[model samples]
Target: MQKLTINLALITPLIFVVMYIIPLGLRDLWSPDEIRYAEIAREMVSSGNWTVPTFNGLRYFEKPVMGHWMNAVSQLLFGENNFSVRAASVFSSAGSALCLWLLVERFITRQMAWISTSIFISLFMVAAIGTYSVLDSMFSLWLTAAFSAFFFAFTADNSAGRYKNYGLAGLFCGLAFLTKGFLALLLPVIVVFPFLLWQKQFTSILRWGWWVIAIALLVCLPWGVAIHLAEPDFWFYFFWVEHIQRFAATNAQHSEPFWYYFAYLPLAILPWLFVAPTAIRHLGKHLNLPLIRYALLWAVIPILFFSLARGKIVTYILPSMVPLAILLAVGLSSAYQKQTRGFKWGSVVNAIVMALIASAFLILYYLGYLPLEQGEHYRPWLAFTAFSFWALFACLAIRTTTLEAKICCYSMMPVGLFLFFWASIPNLSINSKMPAAFIEELKPYVTEKTILLADHPSTMSALNWYLQRNDVYLLNSKGELEYGLSYPDAADRFITQQQLAEFIKTKQNNSTLLIFMRGSALPETQLPGISKRFQRGRFSAYYFAKDTSHD
Candidate 1:
């Protein structure tokens, strides 16, 4: 075990690089979420307006301002690159891991704490979201910190410590509120109150919970009041559209069946899921204990609550993974000490799955079924190499004598795979899902004076973020920008294809106009004087320089 500890201490830095840091810049910012967040942050930095969040210079009330501020600060520190864009999320994920480590250490053993931290970081969903330029990881971080603080306070040995930790929890709750809005307050209330009630310490809420509320409100007051004063309707739109309608309406955004997370969670947990059956069985023996009970309540309740909501996304359940990591770590540790076959079976399952994947890649490549350009011949071998390493490591894990060594090997399995994972993404998916690559090539020709246009707000956002310009016009459809586009001031830029023709006629002959359209976008019959055209995968870009043809 000590040897495993020393190895982990040495390997942790490598894991950080392989799993977390490397992914930040491996691919261009993915559409809507990544580019959307990055643009808002860029605008926040450029416009010097931190109070209101804007996307392409339109009022976007979908979320609160704290996340943009974090991203903005990251951009400031690191300049406008992929690392800066995703730095906030990466740091937030690390923060959550640290908070989990602290709780596991106090409630369980230091060894278990280390194991839990390792497991949490290695989990596929956690690592994936951590490096993505989105607000979910930041939101999950605050939720984890707040919940951990509450747990510490509830279990604290004395009064002063309890209040201090409670205050800390409230502070995080407020920051979480800032990150994603009332959700920060709602989720904790749903979990903590029930937990305190279950502890038969419900009266403690009457005595001390008021202080928590006061502290949270105080922390949120500056931003909350500022936003309300800045845009009086923000609270109304955000509360009704983003919260109420999104959660309860029949036509809520991203609505899915209750089993949505139930299905994706296994994928989220990945190799750990191979062992979860045994781990859960082992942990079941300790469910009645206070620490385990508290963690369980924290993990399970939010999933049920979110399931109750009409709308759902995989990331919505991310905070639930925190206590889950603790529970799984404890359970896995128990099973390891008991010398059960569950661990060996887990390694065997991981090996089998990886081997099958590697074999499938080879079969598909040999059969010529893979969608690859001639130049992408290397991606197949790269993927095979990655999956083969995964299978090899899993076999090593099973053959390894020590529990710590086995778990360490299991944890490192994804690192080799992730190294090649980005390189292995097929160009087909890249063309549709990731537009930044296509947009980056066109960025050199664009300038502040250039009129950029796209059929989709998602594509427009990519142009906006990549070109570092907010004036990218949405051609024909407002999409998510519907509410923002309805305002009279935005009428000039958000126009139809016919209007685009008339609009371009008024521009100077030297002026540049670029249109980016996806595979499904209607063919252009109205666009005139196309000088140059570029087609990449399913996307087509048409360039116009007014009565001049460079073709």
Candidate 2:
């Protein structure tokens, strides 16, 4: 036991360092989502208003305030960089992995617990999303912790202990709700209620279910009530437009086919992808067990629920990872015990797949299918990493005799992924849609006195973050920002093309006016004396000097 404790102490930090910590601040915040969330948190911290979330000085209410609040706190402590902004998610993800270890340890062997937790963290989607500055990882963490706590509470032999566990479950559920809203509560209900019915625990559920609901509401009510009191229509907008309309209407523009998530699930858990079918079969053989039954329901119900919803995205199915990891751990454990042929063949197949992908990239580069400049820059690193993974897996396939060794081999996959990501960092920065350098070039022209105008602000969300100021004028734009702009205080920030032209013509001689628009949207006739100053990617910036003559 002492040795086990020491091993865990050493392993925990090691996992964190490899999975979350070392990669911190290595990449720029990607556009559209990462930058938007980071900037909102920045605005929150700068404005000293925590109740209502704002993006680019507009009252943004697309998401709940918990993520923004956590991010603001991170920035306060870490001084506002990519690492600081993403720190909340990184810690939350690590916390979730720890919780998974503890939860599994309660019901299974400690070795199995460690294996399950490792598998959970190693999955491609889990590691990738956890490192990014997004709310989904935090939400998934809270939801998984809540479910795990509830499972413990529900399965407890003692009545008093069961109620206490219910309280913890409620608290975590409430935290989850704060992270992402009603879906948190909805998912738990969908997962747990069916398990209760299947177990015929009607009396037990009837006795404690209301307590769970009451505690969750108690924990969640303060923020909900506060937001409602501050904005009378907040509840309507949050529940109706953000939740109901988002799910029911495609007009929100996030439309994808119903099969999107189904197709994505296999890839999301890649490298372990070949083992999934065998895991499912193993799960079917053990369905009679209460824990296995719960795992099955936990995994399947969310996929079906999200598949039925009109709106879909890749991360919506993150909650399923918990149960999927549990099932995979069980399957792998059994494979080790029984020397299953499936495990052996699956490892071989994974190796072949890796080799094929790596060879294809090398072939493409040689044949000129890839850009010669970038390809030449990336080829050596890509070749080394890919071939290395292929060789490692191939060796394990050919030489490994024990299932224990095979499971150990799987751990290297995530390490290889991070190494590849680290190697590709330079290329990713160059190819990123966000104009980090371009914005840096515009810094001299942007000042407190400068009048900045964006032809369509919605398309260039990264500008809000890089510019670090929200006083820019928008000309002819409406989308996600529409909600924030609809409020009376933000009306003046929006201007028409004619209004922008007039402002340019009549601006004070001491003040400079800059216009940023898409390359295609640049007017055929330059605005009198406005001269194009910078052009990068799809965006172009024009400078209107105070003393320049009109055309």
Candidate 3:
């Protein structure tokens, strides 16, 4: 059994990598988030200045430098492709799973550790974030590691080891801060402080030595100080505008109601959602366990904390998954031991939930509500998921009398989910807008000397990354680039409509200007000699003719 557990431990991560990591470069980098971060890292590499992160050659201080740094390093090694861009996030997420396993193993049996790690990786949000190019996974990794380290510190037998553990925790927290920002530091404190208080470890909380702070400051402050020295305005923008104003105002465009997470958390843990109630109930019975209280606090406090903030994004509550995974493992482990009737019922209910979700998509597809391109292609996968769920339910209902058999049956669901994502998501093309064919068509019209113009460049961030140029001009719009374009060197990059008209009027000899604008935003009075080169979806591309005598 021990050997089997060890084999499972080794095999699970390999499966995760094949499912999550291997497909990093398979899809085109999507817009606004994936492409934006990729372009920033590309700029960091090109500029040779890692301290100040930039998007499209303008200083972008919206996020800290560590994510860019990691991405930059990945790009350096793998070259700037989808895989390189997302490699950091993938590895970070894997690291997070490993940390969870180690942390759980410290408190529970190896079997439970395996269960926790499996649950963590199998989470829909966790797996999705692992594959995407984003900072949240990396931030979650460091935050989880920090919390794990702190847990060790609090439970340490020797004073010397405790201090060392605390320092390691601080270092991970600092790295988390570098990855995202203050929230990295804030999340750990919110989780750990209350947990310590609940455990009546007041002395331990108070004795969280000064060296921990010093170590964290040492890791995080150098970058802050360096960026401030390089760009004096960075601190104000990062701390005030990006953090404070973003939270305080709904104008940041990510505003959701206070109950947003309440609605989304269950979805984030799909297939596993039905298992959560059993976990919470089991946790309630074991409140005296330090780890149980810690896990509960860790999971619940972040939700409450982010709920208070007006700007709510689903990813903001990602760290909660770690504790929730622990709780699930605990509950499931207990259920496994007893072969409880509740576990059987939970499996049946979970299958029903999965079937209902899949059936809804199938119904939508059949009803013509979902797009044919996505729905028709994805329908079979949805059917497969629903079928697998019911199959597992039948197996559990009829044949699975033992705990191991039930677990094996339960594992089939995530395997089906993995296959569905692997086979179906790329075909849907939901994330990608600038198709390769479109890019290839546009490539022939562009040259080094040609200027690319977009009315709203933010809408086409993928173009910036794919074109591999920073000289793309924005016409009569700043959008998200406003922060970066506000820098003195970038001021000339923003052009007014009048200036655009002037440029069209006085075309330079042998110099071409290509403009990409929304089809709706196209000028009512078209320029006389400008020819519409290509029309794809919502975007229209045009080239200005040198001689305007003939319409």
Candidate 4:
């Protein structure tokens, strides 16, 4: 057991280095969440205000400051670069891998832990959250740490200091809540409840439950109370509106069908998705192994809960990966036990499934389902093929009922390493519009005092962050007409088209630049002397002349 623990310990660091450290600087920071979080950290660092996070001088209170604080700490230590931004996740994911190793090692075997950890390292969703600079990675990290702490507390001997362990678990849960929000709290309830019920230890479970809640609140209370005192509106919106409404009822247009997450589950839980049924079959029998049963509850509850929710994103179901990895490990070990009869067929099934998947995508591409030139076409196919080949190779390499099965399963390490760097990471870093392709053209036109005006107030929060400048303006014409009219400094601040014309007439005494949306017609008489620069995509910037700047 000790030797197995030592072996699995070696795998986590190796996987971390291959997935994170090697490709540290290959890509530029992109938009939507990446730059938004980066900039929030940047702002937090600059303003010395950790309570309320602002973006481009707007009241941006969408998430807590834990992720930004993480980036800030990394930036302080490592210096602000792509790697620095992602460093928090590096430690988080590595720690999560360790948790997986220990959990499996304690209840099952070291072999299952090692194989499961290897498979987890390659899981597309896991790689996506852990390697990239995002909220999910940090969230995943805290969640795993908390869950691991909780598991150890429950199973530790009386001599092992159970209270302290549970307390530490609560602390981790608090950190997890701060990292994202209520999802961290919601996760443990759904994951741990089933196991307690199954064990028929409901009384003992309730006895220890209050301490956990107290510890969680103790860790989380300072931030919660402080935020509520500072801004009740923020507390309400963040906790209730954003957290609760988002899942309960679809707010922010984030609504999806109930089956949306279920449909995406195969991709999120890939490779392991097929083995989940087997794990389910053995769940009742595994009650003797607390850790394995804990894993079953951990994996199953989250999928069931989130799948039934109105809100769905690929990331919403990520917490399930932890238990899923364990179940897959158990499944692999079971398969190894059954390997003696005429070469196990699961490898062949994996290969055929992958080949079929690849062929399906290829057929779709040819049938106009996928655009040949744009969208991620060939890479996903490559990724699937790589996954299939590795699974097949691992299955074939191991002799039935021997240690070779354990050794060969470690092949998932390389397979995961491949899909992340070659497939998932690149797809997110490069293919998404989050990374600006027009920065080269747009940079030259922007000067130190350049003011970017957008028809939509929140048009490109990421772009504003990428430029590292907050001198952007928004024309409040959508629904803030009366609210906008109240601002006394109309000439220099954001205004409506009529206000824009009036401001230009009064203030445009020199050459001024204006970048506005495509099809937004400028007044024929206003800004007439502005020299027209060529339009780029959806934006056109003009050099305005003083006299013709107004109607």
Candidate 5:
């Protein structure tokens, strides 16, 4: 036990450093949710509205307060930047590693525990999203924490008193709920209990379990009730509509085929790809190894659950990666112990081949040899190259009859470190350039008290966030012109180009600037009160002058 604790202490620092020091290149900055969520959190802090999250100064309650709160706190402490926002994910990822270590120590051998935790931290998806500033990273971390606490509670010597660990488990679940929502509570029961029951340890259920559950509810209900009371629709939209109905029904916009997760499986697992079969085989052989069985259940059940789920985002199966790493680690590490020739050569060759393929592709991508549609797809290309190289490096350790072979087989640490620094961190650096340009262009007009308005508002969320203001006016097509200018909401205050023309005919204010979509169908001959037009990326700004008004 002491040795296991020491292993955890050593592994904890290493994982934390890996998560903390990794580069956050501009990989997916403008990708719908990542930057948007950060920007919303920034706006919430700037606007002083902790009750409801707003995007572009509108009631945007798609997700819960956990992520937004993290963002707000991050911005408060470090200023509103990618590094600050992403720190939440980094801490959560480290917590996940620590949780895995604790879980393995309790259920498996000390060596297996280390191996499992190491592989988990090194997983492509976990490494990719974990190091980034996104909700999934934190969500997965909390999910793991909850599950890990539950596992220890469930499998611990009941005579030793289980309530403490069980309560901790519930607390972690509550934390998860805060991070993402109810998926936090649903995940452990659905995923873990089936495996425990399959083992026919029905009597294995302990007394203090209810307390953990009660704590989870205790932590979750207050915020949920507050939101429900404050915005009754908020609870309905978030809990039932988003969680249950979205999963139960189709068409919440996040839809993928049942096989979608299957396609992502290899990529998600990455350097462990070659050892997947062996891991499955080892899982079957060691059914009595409660940790291995639980890990296997953990790995496989989420895939099945998500594959059947209507919402099939890649991160949906994130919690499963923890178990996958454990299963793979046990498989490869145990195979090394078995001294099998086929296992040794096959794994090494596979790694080398995968790495060579990745290196070639990366070289091509860097040289512009591979033509992609846009910059966003760079994730897949980068992931492939990084995973391949790591797999190759790991293969080098797999020699005929040497402990070094085993070490080589699991060389995900360096690979994860390199990708975290070279790939994931730097990804944000690349994406921040365009937004930086927009911010620079808009800076001259923006003042401490400027009432900035954009037609889509989303076009300016990043801008508003960067400028650290919540006063951006979103002029989308919502009905408000009917009030005859007595009063208007933010949505109605936006005068259409047609409205702008009429207003020019009425008042002749030529200096008014109208920001419109580049392809919007504004008739040129409606009113000849156009002073100038400027185009920037996907948006166009028209400076309408009253002098040229000649309908």
Candidate 6:
């Protein structure tokens, strides 16, 4: 146990720092999510209106204020860069892992705590989203905290401990509520109430649930009332459009087939694929254990809940990964104790799978199917090299006698795989996904008085962020901006590609008109009076000089 403790203590921090933290600032902020979150946070800081979140100078209430608040605070501390943008998410994941560690140590075993925390830190989705600028990681942290606190509360021997833990649970619930929305509060109720009923302690909720609600309400009340007072229609849109509509409406955003997460979850949690088979087998025997039951409830119930929701995204199941790490760690620990061949066989399977995938990519690249542009000459080689190393490490895991060495080697394999994959992406793909270079090229043209326009909101967030100007008009004016643009005050900011010519004619004489059309090229005839155009990779920027020659 001492060796295991020291080993995990070293391994987990190494994984968090190298695998998660270092890589955060290494990549450009990907548009739509990363840039959107970054911009919202940037705007929050710039506007000094932490109560409300506005994207591109318009009211955006798709989510509550806390997510932006996190990023906003990070930007203030870390100074408005990629690290600042994604710092909140990394910290959230760390906090969540710490919470899982405490819960497992208290209920399960100290060894299990180390194992679980390691697994949770390096879990695929957790590492991926936790290092990106997104609300899910932060929201997942609060959710994990609430679940852990609730568990602690329920198991407490005395009323004081119980209520105290319950209050902490409620505090997290309120924070979660602010981070996302009503789902935070609702998800806990569904997950916990059922667990309590199973224990025939459902009556306890009636007695102690008030503390949860009162504390949560107290935490949320200030912001809740603040937003309502400021926006007046803040709850109306957030609740009806975001919450209810997203959950049930036919035209919900990102609606997928019911089995979407079920289909992708196995792939998302790929590193632990080796242990999954054994975990399933071990689950029945451990089902009687209270911690196991709680973990199961915590992990599975949310997946089921999110799956049922019409508007589902893979990140919604992040909270599920916490308990899942606990479950996976315990399962592997049991297999080690029993001296089973499960670990060896699982490693063998992983080795074969990784080798096969690496071989397939090499073969494809050899056949000239995977072409690389001039600058990315080494991309394919780097990626395949990473895959080869992973395959080699999987084989090494199989050879190791101790489970600690095996799990460490196995879990850390994805670090090389993912970092290499991220690093080796073709420059063309990079330029398209991350348009910072293109935006920077157009810097001289963009001024305080320049009339900036983007074809879509997907491209607008980066433009608004990189340029540090949000008053830019939208040509498509759709998606998240759809809600913001619907307001009458946003009318002047809305313009379509078809109407660009007429709109440009009105302002072209007085203000320099710069339009960024992303993904596709628009016809010259449509762009009307353009004096200069800058084309970079997949993006095109049209510049109309002040007082254009064309009528």
Best by TM-score: 6
Query: What shift in Å separates residue 87 of candidate 3 from its native position after superposition?
Result: 1.1
- lDDT against the true structure, per candidate, is 0.85, 0.75, 0.75, 0.63, 0.64, 0.85
Candidate 2, superposed: residue stretches over 4 Å from native: 1-13, 250-252, 372-376, 383-387, 422-432, 455-460, 508-510, 517-519, 524-526, 547-551
Kindly report the root-mean-square deviation of model 5 from the true structure over all alpha carbons: 6.0
How many steric clashes does model 1 contain?
A: 0
Error of 3 at 227 (Å): 0.9
What's the CA RMSD for each of the models? 2.3, 3.4, 3.3, 5.3, 6.0, 2.1
Ten residues in a row with the worst lDDT in model 4?
478-487
> How would you encode candidate 5's per-residue C-alpha lDDT over 403-490 as one tens digit per residue?
4334334544345435432543232343332354545565665456444445554445555666766555444443211221223344
**Tens-digit lDDT track of model 6 for 342-370:** 88888788878887877877777778777
Off by over 4 Å in 5: 1-20, 25-28, 203-209, 342-395, 399-434, 448-458, 475-551
TM-scores for the candidates: 0.96, 0.92, 0.91, 0.80, 0.80, 0.96
Alpha-carbon lDDT of model 3: 0.75
Give the clash count for each candidate.
Answer: 0, 0, 0, 4, 21, 0
Candidate 1 structure quality by residue, lDDT tens digits, 1-551: 23443456556556876788876777777777888899999999999999999999999889998899999999999999888999999999889988988888888877777778878888888988888888999999999999989888888889999889989988999999999988999999899888988889987767778888999999999988999999899999999999999899999999999999899999889768898998998997887778888888998999999999999989998998888888888898889889999988988998999999988998999899999987888888889988898889889888887766776787788887777877888889889879877887887777777778888888888888888889888887788898888778877768786677776666635578888887755445765667778888878887877555432
By TM-score, is 1 or 6 better? Answer: 6
How far in Å is the alpha carbon of 176 misplaced in model 1?
A: 0.4
Which should have the higher lDDT, number 1 or number 5? 1
Superposed model 1: Cα runs more than 4 Å off: 1-7, 508-510, 521-523, 547-551
Q: Can you write out model 4's per-residue Cα lDDT over 1-551, one digit (the tens) per residue?
A: 21232354575556557666676555566545566667667777777878776666555666777887888888788876677877777667777877888877776666677777777776767766776777777788778888888778777778356787778778888988888888888888777777768877656557777877899899889988887786667766677766777778645336787688778877776555545465445445555777777877787788788777766677867777877787766655564455432224444455466667546655765687653345556655665566555555545433224443443444352454444435433333343333455444566666665556655433344446657665566665432222322335433545667677656545455435555443354564664455556354444445443354344
Task: Using TM-score as the measure, name the better of candidate 1 and candidate 2.
Answer: 1
The candidate 6 region of ten consecutive residues with least summed lDDT is: 1-10
